[model samples]
Target: MTYKLGLTGSIGMGKSTTARMFRDMGFPVWDADEAVHRLYASGGAAVAPIAAMFPTALDNGGIDRKALKLALANDPEAIERLEAVVHPLVAKDRENFLQKHSDSPLAVLDIPLLFEKGSEWQFDGVAVVSTDADTQRNRVLSRPGMTEKHFEMIHARQMPDAEKRARADWIIPTDTLESARAAVERICNEIVTDA
Candidate 1:
């Protein structure tokens, strides 16, 4: 049986990089962000429903994230409505991915909001990628078009890094790339060996 490992982290904490490391080590990874991206793309399952819900969010036959953000800007409940439309589709996509990779010894599910969404229970184990607050702040601030206010907004919505670490089955600290890679290697080996 394949062991489903949920990987998560706040923005700029190196969750994506760690997920890639797992992939490089031959682990099948289902990325929720990528799933969402595909769902919002043209010809995706979410496009039609989202279009019906927020017609102004479509751009060139796809759901435009910026437009969607704008649509949600004024209404406090808009995000909840959008989530209602997209969440189930994303869950189905994740289920299909798991079925497709069922032969694997282990698989990784990279979810940015794993804890917030109450998804931690679905995984056999959860790994939280983390970094020092200063490092996280620096990394996020360095991103193009990212501002302090935007970072604060996003951070406020996510569980604190310390709390995530406390709840994690494995804490993957990503202070440096080398350290992060080693953690990935170690975790992969441990999982494979135990399986």
Candidate 2:
């Protein structure tokens, strides 16, 4: 049986970098954000449903993310409505990935909202990439087009780092690449050994 590890962290917590480390270590990694991007691409499974719900958010043959963001911001309940349409499709995509990687010794699902969406139960273990609050804030704010309000909005949607750390089977601190890589190696060694 493949050991399914759910990898998660709030925005700017270095989750993507950690996911890459896992991939580099020869573990099959399924990225939820990438899946969503695929689903929102032209002719993707989510296009038709999302188009029907938010016509203006469709550009050419695909969903325009910026337009969709604006639409959601304009409507107080649009996010919930949008999630109602997209979550199941994302779940299906994830399931397909798991099926494809079923033979692997270990599989990592990189989901930013793993805990927030209550999907932690699907994984054998959960690893949370984390850093101090100041580091997280500084990292996020350094990105182009990221404002304080936007950061706050995104931060508010995520579970607190403390809570996530408490729930995690392993906490990988991403303050430094060396530290994060060491943790990844340790986790891989431990899991593979146990298997």
Candidate 3:
């Protein structure tokens, strides 16, 4: 059986970079964001249901994320409704990935909201990537089209970094690439050895 490790972090915490480190180490990584993107792309599983719920979110036979964001912003409950349609699909995608890598000793599931969604239970262990608040804010704000307000909104949705670290089986400090990579290697060694 594969050991499933749920990797998570708030925006700008270097979760994507950490996921890449795992990939570099030859571990199969299933990215939840990428899975959602696949689901939102044209001819994907979520287009019809999402379009049915918010026609304005439909663009060229696919779900337009920007338009969906606007719709969700206008309606306080829209996020929940959207999740209701998408979560099952995402879960199915993850399940398929896990099954595909069943023989592997370790598989990483890169889930941005793993803790917030109460999905930590689904994995054998959880790793939370984190950085100081200032670094996180700076990294996020430096991104194109990222405003302070947008950063705050995204940050608010995630569980606090401290809380996540407290709950994590391993905490990967992403203050620098070297540190993060070292943590990843350590975690990988431990898990693979035990597996």
Candidate 4:
């Protein structure tokens, strides 16, 4: 069976880049964020229910993520409600991914909230990318619409980088593209050999 590799990192920690490296290295990746976006754009499966909960976020064709952000901003309970609707959809999609890729020698689940969502149980092993705090802060703060206050709020919701580093079965410190890809290749080779 394919190894179910779980990959995660904090915001601005190069998760998208790492996920690309994994894909380049030929591992099938199930991206949870993409799944969420899919659900958002998909039929009335979950979006309508979510719209019922937060009406301002849905319109013409799909959910307006920015509008949803505005509605949920500063409202902790609003986030909980959003998660209640979206998480299940993501979960079912993840299960579908696993089932579809069951025969591959290695598969990856690119889950941003893997730890926060208690999703470790679904993986053969977890790899977390880490970088220095200053690097992370600068990288995140450079993004459009990313305020320090919002960064802090998101960080507060996530497991600390240090703690995530400590908990990971494999740690990839992504300071550069080449080095990060090397680490991903190493992990892939290791998993393929071991499996």
Candidate 5:
């Protein structure tokens, strides 16, 4: 049987980078964010339903993320409504990914909201990438158009880093690239050994 591992972290915690490291080490990785991006693109499964739900959020050919964000901000129930339209499509995409990688000894599903969505039970194990608050804040602030309010808003929606770490089967501290890479290697080695 294949080992399915779920990888997650709060914003600016190097989750994507660590996922790439897993890919580099030969694990097939399915990225939830990428799946959503594809789903929201023109001719994608999510486009028509999302357009029906929020017509103003559709651009020339695809879903306008900024407009969607504005809609969510304006309506207290908008996120739940939006998820109702999009979550099933994302779930289907993940299912397809799992089917494609079924033969692999181990595979990773990179879901930013795995814990928040209560989908961690689907994985054999879960890994969280973490860093100090200062580093995380600084990294997020360095991104274009990132502000304190935006950071706080994102943070409010996610589980705290401490809580995430506590729940993680493997905790990777990504204070530096070298350390993060070492941790990834170690985790891969351990998983291989266990399997």
Candidate 6:
């Protein structure tokens, strides 16, 4: 049977980088963030439902992410409405990805909000990538248009990294690139030997 691993981390914690490393190690991966981008980009099936909910935030059958962000800022239900339209589509895509790699010994689902969304039920095990809070804050602030308030707001929506670590099967720390890579490689080693 294929082993499904759920990988997650708070924003700017090198989750994407770790996911890439897993791919380099020859594991198939399903990235939820990329799935969301696809749903917002050209030819996305999510554009219609989204446009219907917030007509002004779409153009030519695609979502204007900046506009959507502004629209959802103060509106409590806008995010809920948006997630309602997007999650099902992403879930379907994820299911397809899993089926395609069912023969593999292991596959990874790189979901930033796996625990927040209670998505771990579908996985065989979970891993969390982590960094010190200051490092996380600095990394996030370095991004264009990311303000401290915005970072705080995003953090508010996520489970605390400490709490997440408590729940992780393995915690991979990304203080240095080489060390992070080694930490993840070590986890892969554990996975192979655990059985």
- lDDT on C-alpha atoms for all candidate structures: 0.93, 0.94, 0.95, 0.88, 0.91, 0.90
Per-residue lDDT value at 65 in model 2? 98
- Arranged by TM-score with the best first, the candidates are 1, 3, 2, 5, 6, 4
Which wins on TM-score, candidate 4 or candidate 5? 5
Q: RMSD per prediction, one decimal?
A: 0.9, 1.1, 1.1, 1.7, 1.2, 1.6
**Candidate 3 C-alpha RMSD relative to the actual structure:** 1.1
**Candidate 3: Cα lDDT at 7:** 96
Candidate 6 lDDT tens digits, 1-195: 778899999999999999999999998989998888888876887888888888888976789988888889869888988888899999998888999998887889999889998878888999999999999999999999999999999999999999999999988899988988998798788886774
lDDT of 1 by residue, 1-195 (tens): 999999999999999899999999898999998999999999989999999988998998899999888888978998898899889999999999999999999999999999999988899999999999999999999999999999999999999999999999998989999999998988898999999
What are the runs in model 1 whose C-alpha is more than 4 Å off? none
Off by over 4 Å in 3: none
lDDT of 6: 0.90
What is the clash tally of candidate 1? 0
TM-score for each predicted model, relative to the true structure: 0.97, 0.96, 0.96, 0.92, 0.95, 0.92
Give me the displacement of residue 176 in model 6, in angstroms: 1.2
Stretches > 4 Å off in candidate 6: none
Residue-pair clashes per candidate: 0, 0, 0, 0, 0, 0
Instruction: Pick out the ten consecutive residues of candidate 4 with the lowest summed lDDT.
Output: 41-50
Please give the TM-score that candidate 1 achieves against the real structure.
0.97
* Model 3 lDDT per residue over 10-128, tens place: 99999999999999999999999999999999999999999999999999989999999899989999889999999999999999998999888999999998999888999999999
